[model samples]
Target: MKIAVLDPDRTQADLITQVLTQAGHVVQTFGSGKDLLGQLRKDACDMLVMDWHVHDVAPVDILRRAKEKLPEGTPMMFITNSSGEDDIVAGKDAGADDYLIKPLRRGELLVRTQAMLRRAYPSQNGAEQLTFGQYTFETRPGRLLMSGVPIEVTHKEFYLALLFFRNIGRPLSRAYIHESVWIRETVVPSRTMDTHVSRVRNKLQLRPENGFRLVPVYSYGYRLEKLGG
Candidate 1:
C-alpha cells in the first residue's frame, strides 16, 4: 500500500514511516498537515494516516480539504490522543474510515488499515474484470467497458459496481453494501445506495425488462442478476 503520514512532529512522522516501510508499504512523511495538504496528490495514495493535531490547521479542516481532493472512498485513518465518543464521531463525520488513539500500535495499524482498504477496494479478492450482462467493468481503471471500449464512470459508480459484481447472485444487505463502499460506519439510509445504483445502471445501459436487472431483494438489499437469471 502507498500511505501518506501527516503529523507535525518529525519524530512521530519518521517513526510511522519506518514502521510502515518495514510492513512493506511505501510511506510519505509530512511534518505538518498544511504541508501535506499543499503537496498532496490524492491519486497517488492508497490510504492516509494523519495525526489529529497539526501545526497550521485543525485536523478536521485538513480532513475536509483532503476529501475534496481525493477520490470518494479513499480510506483515511485519524490518529489522536483523545478516545472520547465525540472525537470518534467527529472523525467519522469528517470522512475518516477509522480512528487510532496515539502512542501507536503497529500490529493494530496493519490490521485495521488493511481491512479498511480491502473493504473500500477489494482488488486482492482475485477479481479482475466484472460483468453484468452485456456490460463489463474494468476494475483497474474503474471504468465500464463494452466490448473493450471504455465508457466513462463516476468513482462512486465504479466502486458500487465492484461491490455488486463481487456479490453477483447473492442479495447483500444495505449495511453490508455501505461498509464495502463507504468508509464511514454511520448508518447511511438505504436510499443513498439505491441512488448510486440507479445512476450506475443508467450509465451501463442496464434495463430490467431487457433481462439485465439490478434486483431489489424485497426486505433484503440488492443483487445484480445476469441477463438470463
Candidate 2:
C-alpha cells in the first residue's frame, strides 16, 4: 500500500517514512499542507499520516478539505503533539479515522494502520487460496489453477491476476498496481505493465466468453469486470 505522510519536522517525517517502508508500504512524505494537498489533487494514497500543524493552515480546515478531495472513506491518521480532548473531537469531526499523540510508539502506529486498512478492505480475509468461478489463486506458492488445471505463469503474472480478482469490480490505477506488484521497480516502463496485463488477459482468457472482461480506462488504468451469468 502507498501512504502519504505530512509532517514538517524532518526527523519525525523520516522516522515515520522508514517505519512504514519497512512494513511493506510505499511512503510519500510532504513537508507542508500545500504540498500534500497538491499531491492529493493529482492522486490519492491508500492511507494518510498527517501532522496537526502545518504553517498557517489550521488542522481542522486542512483535514476537512483534504477529506473532501480524496475518495470517500479513505482512512487518515493524525499524528500530533496535541492531546487535548477538544482537539481530538474536532479532529474526528473533521475526518480523521485515528489519532496519535507526538512521541509515537512504532509498534502502535503499525498496528493501528493495519487495523484501519483491514477494515477498509474486507476482501483481504487472509485466505491461502481464493476462488472465483473456475479460477483459483493459491497464495502459498503463488500459483493459479483453472478448474483443477494448473496454469503456467510468471511470478508477476500470478500476482497481477490475483490483484484483479481480489479487487474484482474496482478500478485500479496503473500506479497503484505497479507499486503493489512491482514494489522494487522505481522507474516504470510505459509498456511494461501493458504487456503483462495483456499476457494475463490472454493466458487467463479474461474475455466476455470467460465470464470476465479486462478493459482499459482512458487516462486512468484498468478494471476487471465480471461478465453476465
Candidate 3:
C-alpha cells in the first residue's frame, strides 16, 4: 500500500516513513498541508499519517480539509505529542481514523497503522480469495475464476488484476502499481505497466459489459471501476 505522511518536522516525517516502509508500504512525505493537499488532488494514497498540530495551523482543520479531498474510506491517523482526551475526540470527530501520542513506539505505530489499513481495506488483508461481481480471484494460487469458468493468467497479470479489484473505483498511481506488483524492480520499464494492464483487461474482459472497466489515468496509473448493474 502507498501512504502519505504529513509532518512539518522532517525528522518525524522521516521516522514515520521509515517505520511504514520497513513494513512493505511505499511512503511519500509532505512537509506542509499545502503540499499534501496538492498531491491528493492528483493521486490517491492508501492511508495518511499526520501531526495534529503543524507550525501554527489550528488543530483538526488540516485533517478536516484533507478528509474532504481523500477518496472515501481512506484511513488517517494522528501522531502528536499530546494525549488529551479532548484532543483525541476532536481528531476523531474531524475524520481521523486513529490517534497516536508522540514518542511513538515503532511496534505500536506499525500495529495501529496495519490495523487501520486492514479495517479500511478489508479485501486484501491476507484473504485467500476475493470476488467482484462475476470475477473471482483465488489469491493464494493467483487464479481467476469468471462465473465459475477458470481463466489462465501469469503471475504479474494475476497481481495486477487483484490489485485493481481490491481498489475498485480508486485511481492508483503508476509507481504505486509497479511497486505493488514488481516489488523488486526499481526502474520501471517504459512499457511494462501498459502491457500488463492491457493483458489483464483483455483476459478478464474488464469492460462495461462485464460490470467493470480498467482505464488509464490521465497522468498517473490506472483505475478499475464497477459499472452500473
Candidate 4:
C-alpha cells in the first residue's frame, strides 16, 4: 500500500514512516500540510495520515479538502496531541477514519492502521487473483493468463490492463488514470496515454469476440465495457 504522512514534527513523522515501512508499505512523509495537499492533487495513495496540528493549514480543513479531492473510500487517519472529546468529534466529522492520540504506541498504531485498511479494502486483504471474463491475473507472480494460457505483456501493459479490468464499466478520467498508474508529479502527455491504451487493447485482444470492448470516451478517457452484458 502507498501511504502519505503529514506532520510538522520530523521526528514523529520519521518514526511513523519507519514503522509503516517495516510493515511493507510504501510511505512518503511531508512536513507541511500544504506540500502534502499539493502532492495529493497530482497523485493518489492508499491511505493518508495527518497530524492535527500540521503547519500552513488546519488539519480539519486539510481533511475536508482531501476527502473532496481523493477517490471515494480512500482511508484517512488523524494523529494528534489532542485527546479531547470535541477534538475527536471534529476529526471524525471532518472525515477521518481513525484518530490516534500523540505519543502513539507502535503496536496500537499498527493495529488500528491495519484495521482501517482492511475495512476500506476488504477485497484486497486475502485475494491474490483477479478474474475478468476469460482473463485471470495472478498478482503474486504478476502474470496474466487467458483461458489458462499465459499471455505475454510488458510491465506497463499488464498494469494498464489490470487497472482497466478493476474498473470495468466505469469511465476513468485521464488525470485519474495518469495519477493512479504513472504516479508522477509531472503531467503525462495525452499521446502517451493513447499509445499505451492502444497497446493494451491490441495485446489483450479486447474485442467483441472476447466479450470486452475498450472504448475511448471522446475528450475524457477510456472505459472497458463487457459486451452483451
Best by lDDT: 4
List per-prediction Cα lDDT, in the order shown.
0.74, 0.83, 0.82, 0.83
The digit string of per-residue lDDT tens for model 3 on 172-198 reads: 888767656775555878597899999
C-alpha TM-scores of all predictions: 0.51, 0.54, 0.54, 0.55
Candidate 1 on 166-224: residue-level lDDT in tens? Answer: 55777977765665566444576677788988887887666766466777888878888
Candidate 3 regions off by >4 Å?
Answer: 127-229
lDDT value for candidate 4? 0.83
lDDT assessment of candidate 1: 0.74
Per-residue lDDT over 49-85 for candidate 2, one digit per residue giving the tens place of the 0 to 100 score = 8887778678788788788898887899997674567
Q: Which residue pairs show collisions in model 2?
A: none
lDDT tens string, model 4, 29-104? 9988889889989998899988888769988899999998889999999987745677788899999988888676
Residue 79, candidate 2: how far off, in angstroms? 1.2
Clashing pairs in 1: none
Task: Compute the lDDT of residue 116 as modeled in candidate 4.
Answer: 89
List of clashing residue pairs for candidate 4: none
Query: What TM-score, to 2 decimals, does candidate 4 have?
Result: 0.55
Query: In model 2, which runs have C-alpha deviations exceeding 4 angstroms?
Result: 124-229
Query: How do all the candidates rank in terms of lDDT, highest first?
Result: 4, 2, 3, 1
Candidate 1, residue 29: Cα displacement in angstroms equals 0.8
